[model samples]
Target chain A: MNYTLHEQEFTQQVADLIQQTACILPEDIERALVSARALEASDNVAYSVLDTILKNVDVARKQQQPLCQDTGLPVFYVHYPCGISTRIITRCIQDAVVQATADGFLRPNAVNPLTNKNSGNNLGIMIPCFHFMEWDKPEIQVACMLKGGGSENMSIQYSLPDAKLSAGRDLNGVAVCVIDAVIKAQGNGCAPGIIGVGIGGDRVTGMQSAKKQLFRLLEDENEYPELDKLEKSLLAQLNKLEIGPMGLGGKTTVLGVKIGMVHRIPASYFVSVAYMCWACRREVMSYKL
Target chain B: MNKKIEMKTKHIQLPMNKINTRKLKLGDKVLISGIIVTSRDMAHRWMMEEKSDIIRPYLKDGAIYHCGPIMVRDGEKWICRAAGPTTSIREERYQSNIIQEYGIRCVIGKGGMGKRTAQALRTFSAVYLSAVGGAAVIYANSVQSVKAVYQLDAFGVPEAMWVLQVKDFPAIVTMDANGNSLHEDIEKKSIQNANQNQ
Candidate 1:
């Protein structure tokens, strides 16, 4: 017999998940911000900015208000055991999104590209994008991230072996491309940002993998030794850029760096960078079927 | 090159004059009081296309905020749940015109504006202030009242123009009337550092 999920109960859980995720700054992100704050001098502009950010996190959690007005595009990743209907799960998530929007946990972010009209309920085609996978586990696992538009605008992709950057198809070229993206993003990406780097995949997969890296905890080390070293080196080099918090200049430009790799076709060499702001609102939940 | 920028806090009243705006310098922290109007992407376009007369009175010598607040209704009154600045660069196309035409003395938002907007601030004797990017609740707490709203029905909540009365709303001057822009300075220095490292 296949395990089943109670429809209404599951929907309510997802709604609760949205509320919790939107209002609470994840512990890892909050800790990273606290550590970053200590790096700056007390009287510096960067210190004040970090101070306000820490206070904002506290106020949002205490008052049950959203961490950001943009609440962002709700992207969900779900994994379920075999025989559980993906259709039902998607519908439940969609319903929960509407309930959350009406409750003010999320803003009306979905809009029609051609008409320039907002759906006004955070629902549109491909709105609240979903990725589903079948796993061996008996329970369902879901993770959601509220990615704001400012940071989304800063995400970039690059083709290696480029003459302009003097970048080859090697890791050195990847480093150069990543630094270039950071320079171009400046404070625009809401600096003291977190960066997710994806290497050696085709364009779309590279970008997708890069975004997936953001779901990792700030303190988690890369499984691959080379990538771990690369992450550490990039973090140090980015802070050295002195873009600081909001690009006003300080010692800390980024709080964390996560990198992932995938195999690519020989014809193409794509490097994708996903820049996440300090807010970094993401959460994970597990449900027993 | 970690140069420490010392900041001093000042409380400012609305409908400010050129002298006050010009007097403010980069890196000064400010707590603003009185009325300010929220205008995002759609509102900016409407202001330029229709030349909104309804909001002009409130904006002249007043402030324009690049924000889209999340609002919830309690009985008959509207309560702002989360209110933080959005990126100001998206409004660059209409911002210079809006600043000049509306006599806007201050522009508030996050992720600083571009060279064109900075030039307008210099020419018009205004300032660009940046709030923390994700500090929505802190900003919403400063709201004394929801004074009025425009284009709510037509433009939807996020894109609507909300006139709010606030007290002690905090921000920092990143761009001043003297053509000094911390954003531009930081960008230039960072690029130089990147090139030299290469």
Candidate 2:
């Protein structure tokens, strides 16, 4: 009646996944950081900070500990196979998060927005946020991202035909807006950052699609040729901004750029940029159903 | 606040007085050694509201780190597991007031704050230091002792007041009392660079 793994076992696996996602920095992110460091000037403070970051990454791994104190809110983008209960999966994920928090693998980061209270167990209203998508494959694929607050606060959305920046209703307009977002953020989004851009959706989905890009591998190319070109161009342009690592002023401001698109109403053109810190913590795990 | 202490290069000897902090320029690399109190949004609010005479003694002449660290209890004692600077801009509205209220000499955080806080630093004879964002693991190693903590039930763990004794804690003087700000300079220059790149 259930998937290949028992429900309890499935829950345990998800907990381990959260723990791994929290503690381990992905290889692609590590590579990008090292390359960014290489690009910085010898005298720049960005170089020294990057050196310390690399060392910090090493220590977190050797100790098998969380990379940052603010381990971040766990976001699960689930590609569930047919016949699985959504309620069951959600409950199991919440249980896993609580387990991780108790074990010290995750900080108690979740808080009640209205009351300013935290459950101390990483469980609150819609905490361990999930994005579910049905898939043809029998096995379940769960891609988890730890969205930290600092960069999340910097996530932005802009309407097309904006007059202030001379932005219009085209891809060029999107480029200007995206670059503008990066520029305003300066070192505040915890640069150097990975920008996940969403174009052509309503305000909500526009932001959602942008966050979805964070789930992609850092080095992976976009599926669409045009989006790919945009990613390449933006990545090149953002670095030239020279915001550098920790905003200390250097040659590297962005490690990667990912963009996703969706159909939108004729009247609206929304572009959302989701700024992700260089820690860029995420992991995708699969199990047979 | 002077004993004519020997200076350690790359480290800011703490319990920082005006003389020592004023000496630090923008982008000066230093590791801090001394007691620093940790407080975030609500703690800042409470400090302003309560302004308790009891705590002012501890806060004066000490650093306020804009961080919400992960701490676990080891029996009666607490241990800092992972402590890194949170974005200081969120506290921008309240930081200046807190600084002026208490004779706070230094502020340690990341992603440098705004104009009001910068002006306040100049007015009050203080400086803003930046700890490396995402440098939690190493920052944790720098926390030599957890002297005390307060207000857990009301504010929660991340929002609690953690009084920490740190040694060789790493940070940079991103905002100096001399009215210089690295973030502002970078923002200005980056806008110019963006125009040129286009």
Candidate 3:
């Protein structure tokens, strides 16, 4: 199966996707937030704070405004056909970012890590990062996540069975490590956050899997029953910790939890916890040529 | 303990002094209406080193906010796009000195400061206001106008200091001048919660 697409139209579509993601909360996230708001204790101030956020979400979508100022670096995961030219896709995405930034759909956020200078259009060396995968599907798949800087700071990786945590090298230990990370966040990751857990991988792969889990919808269940149960239990336990919205103490500390697993070497168990603020700015696009 | 009693929010006004700050307690709700300066990591460090005259006059009665906002330029004027609070824990190293030097009465940001910052707030008669993080669009709407922007070339837009006049800016009292810190209490309580859950 093959489809033809115009280069310029494709670029515009990618830009539209980026801008659309920046301006609106994805449906799953919106529903989760609404439900979380409903579940919060009436006395909890986090409920009111979350109300402000919910209203802001409405305004952002109505006014076509970026939900959060951070409008973090645009990270892309592309699923392109084997015969497609990734070079063209990369260039188109880069140009789209610049256009989006100029249009104020994105903040000029990509800065020179060394010089501390902003590119003014969100394009920098290896910025607006792209991860390409060759897929059999003919339609190009594009997904983006506007991960905030504050929550990104909360992302942590741990080597399991640590004596400090009494964590053993098992799934139970992974649960412990992930929960510990959440407790450490103390609402700093912009609570009522979505926790993405990566288990059973080496350090780099562990972090990657953690991030990839963020693309999964909050309403979706993991195919593996064990991992699915882990996500559910973790979500319940974290909320019980009363880390509530902004850590103000309530029943809805986490909107959801997602876990991804990969085979690891016998010597080590690595876990990466990626905390996403409730905004969860993710959108997907497919252009059938 | 009644979480209901804890949930009752008490609003507060800005331009607070030692006495006014003392009246604030942890977990009290506050809605601040006043002028505040936006400054982040690099701006705080720059203030210590360069002693920028631009920020001095504003410091007399103004609070400082920890934020890196999204701003849109319309001709020569600027509009606040999404001016939400950034995490405040990152400024623990410099917050104490900045609070004292600037004669700042309030420090608005998300998350909260540590023991050292709590001590500074106690000594300086200042309070820490925890704004709702990730509610940038809401915050931007609170801004009345952008008075001025400086150091764009040196610190870049997000890191640069912008003098903003705001009205009814919402926040919670997380750090009171009397040395009570809600964030500290939360961390301790959360750890206990984790232990019990395990």
Q: i-RMS values of the candidates, in order?
A: 3.1, 4.9, 3.1
Candidate 1, A125-200: lDDT as tens digits: 9898998989998988889999888899999999888889998998888899889888988877788889999998
Q: Candidate 2: what's its TM-score on chain B? A: 0.93
For candidate 3, the lDDT comes to 0.86
Candidate 2 structure lDDT: 0.86
lDDT over C-alpha atoms for residue A232 of model 3: 90
For TM-score, the strongest prediction is 1
TM-score of every candidate: 0.97, 0.96, 0.95
Question: Which stretches of model 3 miss by more than 4 angstroms?
Answer: A1-4, B1-14
**What is candidate 2's CA lDDT for residue A24?**
84
Model 1 quality (TM-score) = 0.97
Full-model lDDT for every candidate: 0.91, 0.86, 0.86
Q: Write the per-residue lDDT of candidate 2 for residues B63-128, one digit (tens) a residue.
A: 999988888788898888788889889898899999999889889998898999999999988999
The worst-scoring run of ten residues by lDDT in candidate 3 chain B lies at: B1-10
Q: Which candidate, 1 or 3, would have the higher lDDT against the true structure?
A: 1
Better of 1 and 2 by TM-score: 1
